[model samples]
Target chain A: SQELEQSPQSLIVQEGKNLTINCTSSKTLYGLYWYKQKYGEGLIFLMMLQKGGEEKSHEKITAKLDEKKQQSSLHITASQPSHAGIYLCGAGRGGGADGLTFGKGTHLIIQP
Target chain B: GAGVSQSPSNKVTEKGKDVELRCDPISGHTALYWYRQSLGQGLEFLIYFQGNSAPDKSGLPSDRFSAERTGGSVSTLTIQRTQQEDSAVYLCASSLWAQGEQYFGPGTRLTVT
Candidate 1:
């Protein structure tokens, strides 16, 4: 079984500041996904990274997969209150039918 | 187009009772998944259903947990003789294909008291 460890289990940042959340996997990642969840709600898909050294950005958020494929990071630029939530990283096996292995998630608190 | 949808947004049942959670995937999606998220914890994989193949129940916590997908569209997860540990949010997700990005539903919050 693969395990994912996320750093800084909880973080408090000022609005408009930058912050990064890291996810390290115990095995090589075939597919890495980032999702955001509001308190007591379902997850919202953020981005997916497959290949090593892959980086994808949407608006103020960017996600990168390291060349080793065992580590990934989510960076937020000029964060807002909307970015305050739980960010989870999930890893999937190469096989199409396998379920994802998720990290404990990082709780982000954006102070206005 | 609608994403995944789940029934009984919130359910409260006795500890020894059985409960069923229903999930309706997006139209034309061939892959559906069930995950459990307990309070102060991460999401745990429960099962996976792709097309017509047998479901992957490898992630089920125990024999008391079982799920079935009917007509390759709607899925129902049944927990028998639920315990307090069974309290959590059951989320349903669907992807166009097995390896595609998954879209999640609002989830069913089950409280076993």
Candidate 2:
């Protein structure tokens, strides 16, 4: 029952390598957000994008939303060991009943 | 206080037994949500509560699954007549408003034997 599909379910990279994860939805997106969760821990809010084609950045990570509003991508530059975790993209319909509709998530592993 | 917290990080129960999971949201957070994550699957919406008003129970998978939020703060999810299919990680999240950034708890891993 997941409307969003994340590609490359798992990624393994060298410590300093760069990588990208993609999230595509079957429905038009109103609000898109990213979260990261370490094993056995709670999810940490990463970023939120409202407008289509908008881009946001935090540290070495940059996120971009598609103009069609049905897709988004999270890019990690110079990935670090601390960046290893499960990255999840969630979409909301943007209304009174809006709650996060999450993807299966992409697990990233950074090796030194 | 500082973040959303869930009680009993892990719970083990036998089939036909009942179980309850608790979630405490950050003060002043108006929106609370419950979700279930099956092993190797995406999170499925369970319920949504805002303030003291009626909650959105559209996501309840079965009659045995129910939840209540008291005074717009603490909430509990009750599972009755538990089955093996009920085993999953139950997660709780709270936000100041709908579609806003949500704060999640550690989640309770429920195992039914």
* Best-fitting candidate, scored by lDDT: 1
Which portions of model 1 show Cα errors greater than 4 Å? A93-97
lDDT (10s digit) by residue, model 2, range B34-72? 989886666888899988889999789999999999888
Worst 10 residues of 2 chain B by lDDT: B37-46
Cα lDDT of model 1 by residue, B1-113, tens digit: 98899999999999999999999999999999999998666699999999999999988999999999999999999999999999999999999988788889999999999
- Chain A TM-score by candidate, in order: 0.95, 0.93
lDDT assessment of candidate 2: 0.90
Worst 10 contiguous positions by lDDT, candidate 1 chain B: B37-46
lDDT at B47 for candidate 2?
92
Candidate 1: the clashing residue pairs are none
